[model samples]
Target: MLPKHDVCGEPLYTPKIIFKEQGETKYETTDPYVWCRKCKKYVEVEVTQK
Candidate 1:
């Protein structure tokens, strides 16, 4: 079961993942999970180095 909403106090479903990376730096964020509308889940990833 999903965790209760942080505010509403109900099961909340999130379906999205975002990734930001550059050269050697990488950042990833996700909202639980969900089925991809086309093939598999979709996420935006960016890579950059400092």
Candidate 2:
């Protein structure tokens, strides 16, 4: 999960999963978005794999 703020430090909420990709390796990539109350829209977020 990313920080509580977006690029411009706007509060984020309701993380929604957009899609998932399977790579050749064991790691799986996922794309998600969060609702930005300030912008009144959804913004992409970075997810770190462990």
**Global lDDT of model 2:** 0.61
lDDT of 2 by residue, 1-50 (tens): 34566457875664544444456545433546777777777787766545
Q: Which candidate is the best by lDDT?
A: 2
User: What would the per-residue lDDT of candidate 1 be over residues 15-49, giving only the tens digit for each residue?
Assistant: 45588888898888664443333433433322222
Q: Which candidate is the best by TM-score?
A: 2
- For each candidate in turn, the TM-score is 0.32, 0.46
Candidate 1 wrong stretches, greater than 4 Å: 6-8, 30-50
For candidate 2, give the lDDT of residue 19: 41
Least accurate 10 contiguous residues by lDDT in model 1: 41-50
